[model samples]
Target: MKDNKQSEKDSSADNVDEYLQTLGNEDARERRYYSQEQPFSADEMTRLVNEERLNALLAQSDAFLSSLNSEIKDFNDEC
Candidate 1:
């Protein structure tokens, strides 16, 4: 019974060591990838952010205009 428990403990420790090794390998791979030059420059990133903001604003404006148009049509119909 004691031997069985020891064997289980040894197996669990081995599994933990293997899992830690795998994690270390993944971290090294990620570091290598991030160390490379980025695909987008700072200026390009800024432009992309500004363009996204503009698109969001345009979508909001369109929604507001559509709602206003509907309201105006309903008022006209009631008149």
Candidate 2:
């Protein structure tokens, strides 16, 4: 019975490890793909890079705004 339990635990751990490894591989592939996608024009590439950065920044800003709004609501309730 103890051996069966240990085998099950080992199997679960292996599955989790495999999932993490798959994610790592996917990230690496994405990095390689992005790195190779050089636009025909320098300006175009610059624009594309800037757009990605802007989108990431916007997402961060949205998250911050949501947190701030939540905090303000909490403060208002306390008052």
Candidate 3:
């Protein structure tokens, strides 16, 4: 059972790596700022918004993990 959970975690990590790679590729595209400002099509704008939300969520998650680590360290020290 523990091995299954470990494997699932590993797979999720791999998926995250792949997603980051894909995002990097997408972000590398050149923007045509000087051209006529075309309103962002719905799908593209939605994706951008979702990515922004995802980044915010990730930041919160990192902060939460850091807090947990500090609490665990303090607990261990008190033992």
Candidate 4:
């Protein structure tokens, strides 16, 4: 019947409107867009690791050299 078809169309339109309204919800709409992080490549990562290791070794060597200098100075002063 004509009435039954109209009722089905009305219910379908209402469902679509409800779905559209839900799209405005906070959970549905994020505050900001997500970004992907850039990771270093194999060669770049290895270079960074080596650079840090060399820097640490240099610092340790400098500290050892300073300790030896102080000890020599004390011995010379005593002599």
Candidate closest to the true structure, highest TM-score: 2
Give the distance in Å from residue 58's predicted Cα in candidate 3 to where it truly belongs. 0.2
TM-score of each: 0.45, 0.51, 0.39, 0.39
lDDT value, candidate 4, whole model: 0.84
| Count of clashing pairs, candidate 3 | 0
Give the per-residue lDDT digits (tens) of candidate 2, residues 1-79.
9999999999999999999999999999999999998647987777667787789999999999999999999999999
- Ten-residue region with minimum lDDT total, candidate 1: 45-54
Write the residue-wise lDDT of candidate 3 on 1-79 in tens digits: 9999999999999999999998877665434343547788989887778787789999999999999999999999999
Model 3 scores worst on lDDT over the 10 consecutive residues at 27-36
- Over 1-79, each residue of candidate 1 has an lDDT whose tens digit, in order, gives 9999999999999999999999999999999988996788888888777787789999999999999999999999999
Q: Is candidate 1 or candidate 2 better by TM-score?
A: 2
Candidate 1 global lDDT: 0.94
lDDT of 4 by residue, 1-79 (tens): 9999999999999999888888766544553333344678999878778787789999999999999999999999999
- Candidate 3 lands at a TM-score of 0.39
Could you give the candidate ranking by lDDT, starting with the highest?
1, 2, 3, 4
In candidate 2, which residue pairs get closer than 3 Å at backbone N, Cα or C atoms, i.e. clash? none
